[model samples]
Target: MALRTGPAHAENDPATPSQRQIYSQSIAEHYDYRFGANQPFLPSLATTDTGEFINSKAFPTAKYCGHCHQEAHAEWRQSAHANSFRTPWYTRNVNLLMAEKGIEYARHCEGCHNPTALVSGAMTKGSTINRKFDEDGVTCSVCHAIQKVDTRGTGSYVLAQPAVLVDEHDQPIYGEVSDKEILTHLDRHSKAVMKDFYRTSEYCSACHKAALPRQLNDYKWQRAIFLYDEWQLSSFAKQSPLPFYTKDSVSTCQTCHMAREPLGAIPDYGAKDGKLASHRWLGANTIMAKFYNYDVQMEKTVAFLKNNVFNVDIFGLEKNGSRMIAPLGTEPVSIAPGDILTASIVIQNKGIAHSHVPEQRDMYESWVEFEVTDSTGRVLTHSGTIEPNGDLDPRAHSFTNRLVNIKGEINDLHQVWNNRVVAYNNTISSGRSQIVRYQFKVPTDARGPITVTAKVNYRRFDQHFMDFAMGKDHYPMPVVDMSSRTRTFSLGENPATPPDPQDNPLWMRWNNYGIAMLDAQQYSESVHAFEQVARLRPDYPDAFTNIAIANFSWQRYDDSRTSLTRALKLSPHNARALYYLALVERNQGNLDAAIADLREVIAQFPRSRDAHRELGFSFYQQRKYNEARAEYETLQTIDPDDLAAHYILSIVYRRLGMADKASHEAAMFADQKDDPTASTYALDFLRKHPEVASESVVWHTHSDLEAAPSHGSNAPAQ
Candidate 1:
């Protein structure tokens, strides 16, 4: 449930006080309020002790912050966050949203990018927006003012009232007065900067994870950004009982971005031995730094992108009879002319906490550029070429997620509200790798020493998004070469037969390729890749389990059952295998078998959420309302914010004639039903003005409601 700090009001009321007044009151009343659960909610604005909402003007500028924090301020001034709201690219989109859906709807975008404008009441309809302080995007005061944070991502934070010293006349002191005055009121500065929340990933998640309100998307639930959740599930920040957990090596948001550095101007209170965290907040966004002409920052960003966080290698080559693929080695390979060679470019996400291109993947572009040439500089074959019109080659392999609207058309624009289907998602997750294979005939008269080069390139925004955002005034987005590998092959006689797969050291390479295929939702291709492993090592239980998973995803129930049977026969107590087998049994209408398998899974892995949920569902199917209620109650205890559990419990309680319990569960369901940020009022305006969708070149993808079931919690990981 979204906690409001302001006075209680009717749900349907529209003419309440201005957002500024509400925000001020909320902060004043709930200054000490802490989040009860990690549920997503909108953050309220910060306020002064007098119940006055803090605006951009209330905060000191970056220059003022530099007085005692020179190096940090200097680094921040060159960061993308400093110029976030003032950037031409950003303003263009914000203005477009404002014009199409009114200023009220645009608040969703401003909530993160231009919080100053949002909190100051400048974004209200017909209000005069003050751009004076817009340049100070995400300033020092805005971040330091946060008091409490909800575990939920997407700006679920509460701001504390600023601790300001008053003059003799009772007026607030605004800026730097004097060193002597600062020394006299040192406690106020200490209170502002001493919050432990500053070092937490939850603080960063406030803006990093955003979702489209159900009203905006015209769907019950729609997630737009997932960086926070991705990080939570990663080895760096594992909170759940996942199979992959690295206890010895743990990292936080501050670890990589805020490395320790010597302070240029030591603060009187916070500095420890003249060392402080570097405030560069460096990310893979060199284009913006280059556009802003921050030469030093651009250099640093470019260096970070090319630092081998992601690696690209020519894994292997496939031909008529056999394929020779392995991680890149010093050995040179010999290929014959006129032979059809299929080269595999393996792109691995090695160090990123989430997917390679983490957030706003629809607009951002990450793809592989493969090129093969001869010693004479003659281009033999090339993929991922940039067209004359600034478009990428259609055949190029892209690591992006494509959304489909209700009409089953692609939504090229970044308006995620209309998304219904994740038609394709090829982004590589952390510790995963993708294999893109290209088949081309080696020319009969081809010269010796054919060089193959594969590069993984990243762009902040793709050509299609830029075309819509900037139209004819499009500026070329810089493409960073993330990682690359070059391999040269000399013409020679091929080995009669490729090395045996069992004897080869690259078995894991093939297994990783299969997992990549699974991640991409290419079930058939994944099965084929896993079959190679099954053939090599028939006794390998994991290979059969993988095959079963692919079959299960494809809805081939009999095939899945057969594969699972083989897997269970090999390793009877394999929890993962048992979990999927239970799912297959449930889908096949074998309730008893499903329940039995789920019980076994629970006994093996006590904290299996999926097993518990499935067991409860099976009991509900059998009309055992009391048993269903008990299982759902356990689920509620495990995940307090489990909406599905609450919903099911509501029904079960009602069925059992427990009116009070039913009402309680129903209320919890109602509170969390719709996201606070999803505006029904704004949606009504959008429905009346359907032309907005037509005018935008971004709405290219049409959605198919029944395309495929979403890869939700029940879905198995690759």
Candidate 2:
């Protein structure tokens, strides 16, 4: 298959002179007011002092910087960031946005993908852009000159003037003058450009962590991507004094992606240094590189994908027992004829900062291919195979999220503007694992030995998506094998003695069973398992907490109270236990108690958005409009796109006689409301569409281990 190679059609034309004049006039008119007034949503281009003019002598092209940094520049030239704006896929989508919403609306995308056009006042409808900057995409100076990162997230970086020195004519000087120049000169430039903030994950969050506001998507405020937040919760983001650090201490976004390489001597930077980091920013993006015929980058991306960041294992087998299903796997055991075999395949996200498949999940495909065969190599059962028509096996275990629009239909491709709900999300989180069980009946006349093979495969784009994106273009998107495991078992052997439940630490066995039950939503069974944990470890608060949660989920309010009481007795001020107790109280009509408990939770954890919303709702129920309005306003600050908050605020403001505010809130609520037919959980949707559910596994975070107690007696109770 030959890859398509050409400059994006959008880049072929420059902005018309009339459009440029209109943009220049608009910027001149709005610059001072927008920047000086501190309008939060406005771009940094509103500040005239930043000197973003491409024609300016101080602003050098990326090629100018490449003169001295040859190796880094060469590597970057092949990276996706280099071709970000010029890619055919990007141009196709962006042009569609322009045609549908006009150039003014298209600026939303240009803010990140074509910052140069945006900052130079060339992003208006019909305006021509600087071809040089558009091709550069995220250039070296664009990233290096970032002065500050806004905690608000979503491409909130402040651009400062470039660090390079200028000659008498104010033209920027590039590279070293000689082998030995004053260290201060280079140090000044480095200090201005490479601030310490650039080394942190927060720097990447500026663009990587994005969300669509209600105004932009014409839907409720939705978090479009969350790679940065995912990393923050993982072990990789921990610094000193934080307990979740990996064995090697702290690791930043730069650590794995821009790993240091030994480069030969380059003027003032030192000789043959291994501390020089590569600018390739290699990731799982081989498709775009292949489209552009960037062989070097394509090879590096493939290598990165297969670098053992994930592990797949056939952990155990399950069968019918006195218990609904008992785990049977310490070692390989015999399987008799007519017996049902339930094999559990565990896929662990080991090293990735976010979920195994991070951003643009709708475009990619990751699945577990499982096969079982006899000695003669005759296939017994096969899953995750691709059909000639490019459809995945209907019963395969796939790690992909199914996004649906307001009409409750699949988005199909990267039609992100139409997305309303994540119908199903099965991506495994960092340092987490998902267990998928496949059951098959052993044939009565089966051969002696049976072999099981499981492989985790990843493809850059799903076939349907590729076909839609590249019409009449036949490029083979390679399916890279991320991880695999094999296990063989013989028939006619005696069933091994089931491991004594007491042999291992009682907590471990019960905890495992409890978690498995929770994952399957077997609340009653999970409660029983957790009860065993509580009996074995009386002082452990987590087990009791788990019991309470199970009972709460099961809607046994009185029973939930009993377990929550015990959990609170073991550890006073347990946030989770208190939160659930409040839920039980609210459900049982103990509104005052619920309000008090929720307030306490908020006091302890001010960032608890749930607590604030619950308390706000409680106030609204009691007609305390002022208190409810205050709480909802705080929620708006915390999460501007909170659907429930906007809905309630509309009512609260109306009751308070603030007609304008109420009207504004009502408009936002209308835009953000969930589809009336949308199901809260994918499992609910799957219940009706069993065919699709059978092939996919949706791994929601299980809360059983949230408050798991420490082993030692001296350890503090959660």
Which regions of candidate 1 are displaced past 4 Å? Answer: 1-55, 164-188, 215-220, 240-247, 262-274, 321-334, 404-413, 417-422, 467-474, 494-507, 520-718
Whole-model lDDT for model 2 versus the true structure?
0.65
Over 585-612, each residue of candidate 1 has an lDDT whose tens digit, in order, gives 9898898998888788778656456667
At residue 344, candidate 1 shows an lDDT of: 67
Query: Candidate 2: which pairs clash?
Result: 14-128, 15-127, 15-128, 155-206, 220-672
Q: List model 2 lDDT by residue over 284-387, tens digit each.
A: 77678778888878777888888878666565666542123333334436578787777766666767888867754776778887777878776667667765
Task: Please give the distance, in angstroms, between residue 227's alpha carbon in candidate 1 and its true position after superposition.
Answer: 1.0
Each candidate: what lDDT? Answer: 0.64, 0.65
RMSD of each: 10.7, 10.5
The candidate maximizing lDDT is 2
